[model samples]
Target: MKLVVLGAAESGVGAAILAQKEGYEVFVSDMGSIKPRYKAMLDAHHIAWEEGHHTEANILSADEVVKSPGIPETAPMVAKLIAQGTPILSEIEFAGRYTDARMICITGSNGKTTTTSLIYHIMRKAGIDAGLAGNIGHSLALQVAEAPHSTYVIELSSFQLDNMYKFRANVAVLLNITPDHLDRYDFKMQNYVDAKMRILQNQTADDTFVYWKEDEHVPNELPKYSDPSAKCGFTDEAQPGSAGYAANGTFVVNAPVHFEMPLSQLSLPGRHNLRNSLAAAIACLAAGVSPEVVRQGLSDFPGVEHRLEKAGTVNGIHFVNDSKATNVDACYCALESMTTPVVLILGGKDKGNDYAEIMPFVKQKCRALVYMGADNSKLHANFDATGLPTADTHSMRECMEHAVALAQPGDTVLLSPCCASFDLFKNMEDRGEQFKAWVKQYGEAK
Candidate 1:
């Protein structure tokens, strides 16, 4: 079988390696320059690959194509491939056909990484054989290549769901939906929402859809995609169903036997993360995790890095790295989680952000604002009436120094850029690491 892989990043490379191992004739093509590390991998394995071009003739001849989630289905080459009647599938869907692992999948506009990581953490804590993959750690395909596990906690994105068909999660989690990645959906809210709903497309009655019952967007339109047999819900503010709710400070799920744990006992803080916590707990329960394991896991899980991770204290002022907050809605989540007044550092490549959405939170928690990115005008324009001290800094170091100079004891300096990090750093991880390093230096100076 001739199989072609697109976008030679983590997912694409892993898919190519897996296909080669399975005796399928594999070729990898990337429209952009492939990373040196991935290029090395392809070379070491003698895998045929091309970069900076998508040889049209070669790609369209394949029996199937495994697409990296980052590539849209609307690319001209992709359209041409479709026009030629060639099949394109996500790396996840392609990989799933070969694995028998019970899948635990997490999705939402936010909190997916935290919840997915937590479930993987708990599964390992409980001595369950679980592998972490998808939008988080290593590629799921690579993990499958190394050692297939009894369970997999996958952090899924709307992009990954776009090409997936016939892939079913043993447990599916929907955290909360808000306007995110709208550019990909042609700037339409419903189109993006519809993309998120795709996670439930193949779920069955025997399967489970664990979600936040109180998320404003999910509940109102969920019935459109409802599957009565798979319905399971969780809410921090109310009991949404017969099970998986916060009643008496615990998330309790009734199905597949009862499970419960105190809400205060969860290690991850904030109303938003609590929602993530609730969804992860329910997924664990549906997968047959005992109440004792759930309870222990919830209280012990430390939380994922780059989503409100602690960077250490300089004097009495704390620095937090939330560089993963790439949109206004995610910024709202980060701000909502803060206990102290924040000298908030935010900015980057704007994705047509509606700063009005976060105005209320900004008016309340932000003591001062430091912007880091290529474009700060839109942020400044939206914040005109908020009356918080604001400054535009072009890099992470300047943003940190300016933010620290404005902060005093008890004030938190948060690096929760509500925009993509490409303007100032290579990506969110690079942005986050720079923030952490500066904070360490800032701490030592005091």
Candidate 2:
């Protein structure tokens, strides 16, 4: 069958490779430049690909299309495909059809990366043959094509879940659903919620669906998408019918296997992490990992980068890089975990964000605020009333200067910009790296 792949990045390139391996005629098209590394992969496979433009004639003739999660349905090419009644599948969906691996999928607006990594770490420690894929690791399609594992621990985003129809997760984890990516969903909360609920699609009684029991949205949507028999829930406090819970300063997992560990033993800190730990432990246990292994994994698993990562200390001031906090809810978690007074950095491409969600934390925990973005008007309008010391900066250098000036010796300068970094940087990782670099340079000069 003729298979066309759109957006020649990780997911798109990986999908093209897998489709070629499956003996389908594969073509990759990107409206933007393909990275040199990806170009080489396509060349090595002798696959036909075009960069910087898409040929409609070539794309229109395809029997099926694998679209990058980054591309929205609003894109002209995608809309054309829809208009033509062509099947467009995500890389995750296409890869799922080729692999018999037991899928352990994790999704949420926050903590999904940490939970996905933690689950992978635990599965590896327990000597289970597993591959890390989806949002955090190598593309699932690439892994399925190159090195298929007996099991796969995937960190899924709502974008990846949107096009997935027949993919089934043997163990599914929904961390939490909050107001995020509303722009892609026409600024509708239920539309975003419905996309997240897609992770539970194709799940059966034999499949396990693990989720945050306390999420404001998940409980209301659970009955609409999944069976009660497949439900496994984790929460901060023990409740009736909970699969995992925390009590008396210990994390507990009941189903799949009885397990408990002191909350203090968890490597990742904060109340949010306690819930993350609960979810990971439950997922690992449900996958048949031993209780002892899960405990050790939880205690030793390293935290995710750019999510509450410490950049460095400069002149007795600490800097944290939480660039992954592109939404208000994530920034709320970062602020909630801060013990030191924070000179909070906030601003970027606004995603129709409601700063009110984090207003309480900002008023309580922040000593000062730094607005860094192409536009800081929204931030100012929301926070200027707080009357805390504030600075407006369009660049990272200026942001660092203002942040350092506002911070005292013991204060923490956190780069948890509660918005997308595209206004000033390539992506969140670039924003975080630049923040760390500035912190390192400042420390050296001091």
- The most accurate candidate by lDDT is 2
On TM-score, the leading prediction is 2
Lowest-lDDT window of 10 residues in candidate 2? 222-231
TM-score to native of every candidate shown: 0.94, 0.98
Model 1 lDDT per residue over 262-349, tens place:
6778898887877777777778878877778888888989777899999998789999999899988889888888889999988898
Q: Residues 1-93, candidate 2, lDDT per residue (tens digit)?
A: 999999998889999999999999999999989999999999999999998899999999999999998899999999999999999999999
Q: What TM value does model 1 have?
A: 0.94
Note the residue pairs that clash in candidate 1.
249-263
Q: Which stretches of candidate 2 lie over 4 Å from their true place?
A: 226-229
